[model samples]
Target: MTVEVVIFVLMGLTALGGAITVVMARNPVYSGLGLLGTMLSLAVIYVSQLAHFVAAIQVIVYAGAVMTLFLFVIMMIGVDVAEDTAENLPRQRLVVGVLAAAVVGFAVYLGVSQGFDWVPAASGEPVAEATNGTVQAIGERLFSTWVLAFEATALLLTVAAAGAIALAYFRRRRAVRE
Candidate 1:
């Protein structure tokens, strides 16, 4: 097998294992660690695919900032307490199982219909332009085309963070009043 294939297989397996660990682990901290592993593995895969900018963002934004936030939330919520496993909704497990099965079935159907050939037939197109998958290209597109959407997303995140702080402050105030 080729080196790229080998690396892809290893990274894919690591990502799959991490995802399984995240789902199966009962402890919130362990689950967060698993998620971190998954994100890091995905970043490696992005690097292998020559998406260096995306890989850096994956590591910095997801594995760094997002995972830290997730772990902080877990710690703040009291990691010593186990999650309640009792089903509050009737047939919730059954409904979730059916939904999962449907999703898997649809994925399988799409994959089969699209033919699972990994490598595409080569077109006469030129390969490896300097602009391809570079930080410069990404910045150009982000600022030129998607600038408004990016600004909107930033505003949304700021609003969400402010809302969270407001909620926490109000909760603390209410508890103090009590």
Candidate 2:
């Protein structure tokens, strides 16, 4: 088999394993680590595709910054690591699992039927220069072409943070009163 094919297979396995671990892991920390593995594998895939800027950004932004943040949050929250004490494993899980399977099936069907090709252009055309595809290009596009969407995302994050803080504060206050 070609080296490219081998690399693709390896990355695919890494991604699949990470995805499974993310779902099956009892500890939130392990799940985060699994996601980090997935990100790193994906970055390697991007590098193989000659998307050097994207690959670097993937490693730096996702595997480095985002995963670090996720680990910190998981550490701060301190989830119980025991798998045995997991409650309500049936009805809700079944529903979610069914939905996820349906989505995956539909996606696979669409992919097979459409036969989409995303091969980069091979002609030695001078592509417009881009700064390393860091979070900066993403931010620029978001602020320019998708300003409203960017604002909405920021607003959503703000609301979520506030809500979490409020919930924790209220819970603590109630515990103290009791």
Q: Which candidate has the top score in lDDT? A: 1
lDDT of 1 by residue, 6-59 (tens): 888998898988899899998878889988988999998887767889999999
lDDT of 2 by residue, 129-156 (tens): 5344545666678689999987789899
With candidate 2 superimposed using the best TM-score fit, by how many Å does residue 45's alpha carbon deviate from the native?
Answer: 0.5
Q: Report RMSD (Å) for each prediction in the order shown.
A: 4.1, 6.2
Clash count, candidate 2: 0
TM-score of model 1 (CA atoms)? 0.72
Clashing pairs in 1: none
What does the lDDT read for residue 79 in candidate 1? Answer: 84
lDDT of 1: 0.87
What is candidate 2's CA lDDT for residue 163? 95
List clashing residue pairs in candidate 2. Answer: none
For candidate 1, which ten residues in a row score worst on lDDT? Answer: 122-131
